[model samples]
Target: MDIDFLKSQLEDHDQSQLLWYWESLDKDSQEKLYNELKHLEFSNINGYFKQAMEDLKHASDKIDNLLQPLPTEVCGSVTGSSPEELKEYNRIGLEEVGNNRVAVLLLAGGQGTRLGVPYPKGMYNVGLPSKKTLYQLQAERLLKLERLAKQQTGKHCTIPWYIMTSEHTKQATDDYFKQHNYFGLEKENIILFEQGLLPCIGFDGKIILANKDKVALAPDGNGGLYRALRKWNILEDMEKRGVTNIHVYCVDNILVKMADPVFIGFCRTKKAECGAKAVEKTVPTEAVGVVCKVEGHYQVVEYSEITVETAELRRDNGQLTFNAGNICNHYFTLDFLKHVSQVEQENQLKHHVAKKKIPFVGDDQQIVKPTEPNGIKMEKFVFDVFHFAKNFAVWEVLREDEFAPLKNADTAAKDTPTTCREALLSLHHRYMLDAGSKFIHSDGSSLSDIPCAKKAKESGDCQKSENDDQFNKCEVSPLVSYAGEGLEDLLSGKKLVPPVQIVMGPSDITPSIIQNVTANGTTN
Candidate 1:
């Protein structure tokens, strides 16, 4: 932390960037750094460096210890509530929008190399017509949710969007949002924090120093959310901001409900420290973690751990013993977070090991080669905190509209751009049908007597002659539907029909150009 000592260390690594960082520090920040170094003054510089390394290793190790399998299930049995018993939940969920609160925490630190893009995953445009990048779409969701919360609660329930970035993504992520004016979000409310990194290890688990002064480190994985929250002092910040709960989800999920109020209200009503939104497994083979009581506590068991017995567990009525699945969408209470942070015995969270390819510089520091899965990187799962909770709950939701993970390149089987596009299109498809739009038949024949199509049905009224084979069989879905629609289609719909370009909230869909759409078409 000492300026001179830091300079010497930077020189040892021959990393010019650290010098730039030091020079960029303001007076107050520099003074704070000097104070932090005061305790090290008695030790030799090398000893001080070694001590720092030890502290980091200890913290990382503690996290690793907490991940060990639990001895008992802390979560109670899943409620098999009948429709009548679930009335209150349905009522509260539908009755008010703003009455419940919402917050968005995006884990978006990695690049889009898997997706074959040059930018961050958030910056990758999913081939939509509006050309909205992942970040833009997500930011828009946050803005709309903020408005809905305000309208429903009659109070300004600010939707503070927290983005956790890594060394690889912080600058690019910030610059993209900055160029777009944070997409109309209040700049102060959009918090960005850097995730902690663990030193990269070789195949033997020995730390690989990037240079004489620093060890190469990688983002501790998504499970590192808690530590990132702690290092950034986010819990205190949330409490100070009067944010009672936080809805945490990842950035790659295009269909995630940003800070969904229903989930928040449910957690609040149940007095639960954690709330997880889940989807029933389509089948036993589906690749999703199951939310179930482990030993005796509520936890998400990885699909890999589910043996035939566990996966086949069923009650007398033939219902799945573990029906709820972990979608990674969660809600957590602020008070619980404080308690966990304060309790040292409960402080260490267990870590999951993930193997990844890491880049390493050679002895000359000239040529760098990316290594193969050399070793496992330790990280704590956010759900591992479930054990610390006194109460827990899971809310079931539709998977098609809520879960789609983008983790591969265009070449990968499931995560390709084709699949992402289809997923978005599928959401749009459902939204349109719900809006009373029918799909065009292959025969170009009408499935229903839609007013717009009816008016254009006359012979030669549109393009092809009515008598022509193409004319009688051609059918097309409505142009304007939902978020990921092509802008060209929306424009065409507007010019040819009444209203197009529908925008959607968490629970409802309306025309993006609402006033115009309503004026031209009949409003119920």
Candidate 2:
């Protein structure tokens, strides 16, 4: 913590005004400020400050035009219309997984602020019957995928799990994983790294100070994944580990398929440098980004950027023409990441501006929590690099089965804890029905076909029929079956009580036998 060096750097960047409130700090506050500055590498502070200034200056001009409908081509033939093509993709994906050429990158740098929690979003429990955290659920899926690859290829392979945390979430997330023993996966195979953070800039293009000794800083955004990979030397590690393709996804997506082989295979088989997993938008006005081409380059256009007429435009098949909603799940070849990491190629990515109500030290040196937005946080999106891809692919998936995100608290109807819980329960209930399991109520009657005389005649209770009971309270663990694939055989001739959790227990059952056994709670 060289005071002279710090002052000189600030002077050089015309940012010496940052020290106006410095002299007012007490001895302890000065020491804290010194440490914070030192840890943030104040020697190189010029670059960050300058970038923030430039971002603030150009923020207004960066709002993309939504006048024209983006030109988007279907990535591949629809799976429903062409099953063989999808089969080929699945086969290719399995082959890649078996060959040990894949890795999973999870973007978990976000805090659960929107969810009204102070911990990492991955640590929030959505009140499932198993009470599993998002991290546990995702980790277990990777383990199951590993087993599936081994079974299909007759070779053992470990898919390395890479998680990108943030300064805000790194320690808490680390402690959580340690407590859960890395969710039953090999601890060494799971790598956790922090994403970069940037200082918040006031509307006037000056950095905001949360306190006399501390500058207000925030995570740089998911797009910072590229910078993080380069900064942390993760790209080099991936290369050494023989990871050819990376499947990157957001941590909030409870249904994300880690290192999804089919997606990796699709990209590899098509010789695409980048691929995005998209789902057809549920409606024309869905508030999700649409993966489309702009002036002949691939990119994601936010819902707010499109005109209502353009959004409502439909194709001959009665589907929204620009319906491929980007789900923040992507595949990138190792070579693509390496290329993007280079200085010359890195500039292809662009930054977006987010306006937020940043609490900061006011002129009176008091922390003020403003009611309205007071500053802008600049961010680069991972998808911003899509235009740099030599060959880009988009794979459409079923949204209901693969895209329930836990984002909001109890307030919102969708993307909230309630919805996420219901989605999981619904999925598990579907799995049970597919597995030939009958739901029975407490009255010893078939839930699905309760006699009118036996059915509860109460107003609200009568409305809650077999269909409602199916998903009332159900949870299926990934250790039991990933994506409900092998449950039919495991639960065959077995009755499962509703409001039960199916988990893989600590018994020496063979993989073949264990694949179908619901160990935790099942009826005869």
Q: lDDT per model, in order? A: 0.58, 0.76
Kindly list the per-residue Cα lDDT of model 2 for residues 1-524, writing each as its tens digit.
58888778667656666677877888888878777665554434445545656765754442234333333443753455366766677678877888888999999999999999999999999977677889888988888888888888999888899999999999999899899888778888889999888778777656778887888888888988888898899998888888898998999988787887667767777798998999888597889998887776778988877677778888888988888899999989999988887766665565567788999988887899999998877677888888888688888888778889999999987899878887787777777778877666545555652323325645445655443433356667787677777877766665544665676632324332211113364543
Cand. 2 Cα-lDDT? 0.76
The sequence of per-residue lDDT tens digits that candidate 1 reaches over residues 1-524 is 45677656545544223233334457776565445333322223333234444544554331211222322232222244455535554345323335433456778777787787778888877765345666777777666655544554566656678898998899888898899888767888889998866655555434454443344566777767776778899887776776667778877876776776556656666777887888776466566777765545567776666555556656576756666778778888777766665536234665555555655545554435565665445555667777676687777776676777788987678866656655665565445444444433334454332332335646546543322221112111222222323345333322222122344433344435421123224531
* Candidate 2 to native Cα RMSD, angstroms: 4.4
Model 2: weakest 10-residue lDDT segment is: 508-517
Instruction: Identify the runs in model 1 with alpha carbons over 4 angstroms from their true place.
Output: 1-101, 210-214, 316-319, 343-347, 361-372, 439-500, 503-524
